[model samples]
Target: MGVMNELIDPPGIGTLTRILTESAPMVEWKQTAATASLLGDLNLRARTDLVADALVADISTGPVPGYTTASASFRAALAAPKFTGWVLWPVSEAAVTLALASDAAEDFNDCLALLAELTPRLTGEFAVRRLLARDMDRALAAILTWTAHPDEHVRRLASEGTRPYLPWAVRVPALVRRPEATLPILTALYRDPSEYVRRSVANHLNDLARHAPDAVVDTARHWLAAADRNTGWVVRHGLRTLIKKGHPGALALFGFPPASVAVSGPRLDQEILTVPGELTFAFEISNTGTRDVRLAVDYLIHYRKANGSQSAKVFKISTLTLAPGESRSISKRHAFRQMTTRVHHPGLHALELQINGAAHGRTEFVLEMA
Candidate 1:
């Protein structure tokens, strides 16, 4: 029954007070105070149902400005509870965004239309991703559409929002288990006109590289072959994991390769002391190149932990500039104790020689029981 003040929060509450007093002279002060109190309670813990009911009532009775604030506050409140479990909320972009942000992980699903339209402008892309994480099939479908959205923000969200292990969001096992499923989405964004979107794509691909190095390497290869200037850097960035693991495709992309491989000894005396156990390495390095070249030679050891899983640790025991026809023998004593480093069980441990930047040769050695 009165004019509404459209003020952004941190609102000038006093302005609303004056507007309410003057616009609705017949309106009781108590009612106005109640409205103000409801607005203020946004920062507190309140019941989701109660807040939703109050907001719906406000939206139905008040002017548009009041309706907007009430809706936003109500959605914010709902986000704290099981909003995702109840999928029947009056779907507005604001309410949908908030519901996605909720910690509730029951039967919630996103409306594709709203998701396509709103995902770009939504502030908390990571929060929205949590809801999607529960349903990869749905999330991928919606993200595919959003990837082509005209808005850069929305396009960016299509990639950033779908990380395999996005923080605070539900972990999408599909991405981690089978990163290949994400290739379609990544492919679409690879050549996107928007650098922002492309960068997100690169990061997403890199995320995939953690679990699926081959998949990322393939994608990077295609991008690099095309030599698309817009996405060249993105391809490079996306290859980080593969490069780190000494994948040949990745190293070759950068025009570098290891020319030799050799090993020194199987002696136990030179082993380094590890509290729980000690590690000994015998390596033979060879220079296959004709020119004398400097190389960063080291071995990567994968040790088993108490939990029966393996972890990789790198040791840089030697670096040398070798003659074109020279060979060298090297031994490294790696000691380990406690569970701090990778645990070595009674199983075979993986060993690899990294020559220059390439993984030259790989072998398995038994980790004898102590």
Candidate 2:
């Protein structure tokens, strides 16, 4: 709704300075004073790095102070009741930074524990990437235990922090290459009582689907076998990407089989669209099969890129079963606005129907920049 960077916009510098000073009385934090008023121009990740590096630099003067002082300072701050919120983003990062430097096994464990402790305030999700990058197995071995933690936040971290493609978090290349690595964690929590934890598990599965759809579908199958009331939502969300792409396994998992249907007129109300406006479009699907058939109807917007080529994005529309000779009409009002995620470039565009993973009824349009 607003500038995306403001979403992670931390507390004011004065607020951070005061909190740092008061939360960890054991540390001097000298370098904290000089951080420029330069934070506004930076996005969330850079802003976090700026503050964290300063905290690392200011930890302690002792020769081996990096890991020692920072961990101590973070622990001391944990003891203070007020050490929480978006400001903890940088604090967690600082702890991870210092821990990455140490060869001690305990430091790695402490770092993981520190992240879990810090997550309740503000996610240590971003910071934990350092540990994951350093040694994924070691980090995951420890993180697996978090699924059983009493706090749902910690359980969510166990899934979310290990996501193969966690947004705004650093990529764990190993996780991408080996999507199955985190499946055990997901397995443990898919039926979790807390919706917050299950939601993270769903997103984690969705991330895995980007790289390994088979593994994700299989995992979803396992989850289905042992489902709770919330498992349906989790499995559906986890399979979203695969469903959009028309992966048969995902489609079948959702009861949307290969549909024998005919599509007609994804006709646009206007063949030309002005920016910051709305386009109304409608389409119809009819059963072409003799027996009942289910359909997962989707739509694609082939957006024009800057170089005149097009990239398509799929959006879900609806799902239904059509009996022999039955027809259903669908209509939608799609808004075109300049959001941070996508830009509207004036050019030739197209819309199409995707029924059960098959493309049909393509209609062309033009986007005129307003």
Candidate 3:
């Protein structure tokens, strides 16, 4: 990615300079058209408003490399007092949109803050989020007030704006790392009168679920019990993966009944491998008796460590709706990579499969570490 020259400069002037430089080349056409539109306006404020409107109209234009089109046009447009108020609003929106389309550079951060100031005036909630996604702290500060704003649009931004992995916006890894701070914000908006705002709250809660499953599950359960169909939809969408894979707490939240399950060793029913490297396992489940049943089958791996202790982590292997006579098989591969899980010491590793809430089967294999 090419760095913007003004990106490295100090905040205020640097941002303005970069905007000017990037927009200078296209200034002639944008400003000329704007000025032409305001030819009959004698009042200064009205003239500025017209210019501001013009800038917004042409904001989607390109940077043209060395050309300073947008920056110059903005300069000419901002000259009118009428355009000033309009200036920040449109410019903020345009800048936020632009930032999402590019990587986070110093210029991007500068643009984000500049745009955030005008958030109170802008009607788009998503725009505020795109800007906030750059810096979690700044985003939290600006939006905390917006949550109380009378405008539903602004209020929604309070929740929608701080989503950890909001689509099209830069992902805020910090927020993802420490999701507790986000709880109050989500709680305030989860039951918002406006469905739009409430939907955002649900999504925010869901985002937190990836790292903090317990929190997400708890919050979602509280919301789903009293939520309407639309609200329920929002909660379900957010919890889709967790529910589909039959997360224990998630299954319980959805009122799924427990069913008996059976899992066999790797490669017996399907292909299997013993790993110092990688392995594959085939898990099968059947409804032995009657009664319609919805069940969740999960697996946990116990890695043997040099210290002779075992470390275990759980993963959802499958969810099934079994009828009077139904059986299903799922094949999964386990890679002994440093990323997913750590293999402490080479020894006999144990695997346990949990059905509903009980451990139903076990398998063991030797892992040799070189």
Model 2 TM-score relative to the real fold? 0.79
Q: How do all models score by TM-score?
A: 0.56, 0.79, 0.47
Candidate 3, residues 1-370, lDDT tens digits: the string is: 1232222122422243344445454533344253443435234334334444445445544445211333335445444333332234335455555555554355555444444344454433444655555566766765576667676766766776677887755466677788877877876666677887877787777788888888888878777767765666767777776665456787777766566555454342223334445676776677776776787767777778778777766777766788876877777766775444454566777777777766656777676655
Candidate 2's displacement at residue 267, Å, is 7.4
Between prediction 1 and prediction 3, which has the larger lDDT?
A: 3
Top candidate by lDDT:
2
Model 1 spans > 4 angstroms off: 1-94, 97-124, 127-142, 191-196, 230-232, 256-269, 272-284, 288-298, 307-310, 315-352, 356-370
Count residue pairs with overlapping backbones in model 3. Answer: 19
Q: lDDT per residue, candidate 1, 1-370, as tens digits?
A: 0112122121333333343344443322243234444544342112223333433444445444332343333334333322232111222323444444445442144333444444433433544454556567876776788777778877777787777866545476667887888788888888888887887887888888888887787788787777677777888788866666666667666654555545443344432333456566665666666777666666677776667787876656555777877887777766654463344466656766676566645666566655
Q: Tell how far residue 260 is off in model 3, in angstroms.
A: 4.0
Candidate 2 regions exceeding 4 Å error are: 1-27, 33-47, 262-286, 315-318, 325-351, 361-370
Model 2: lDDT equals: 0.84
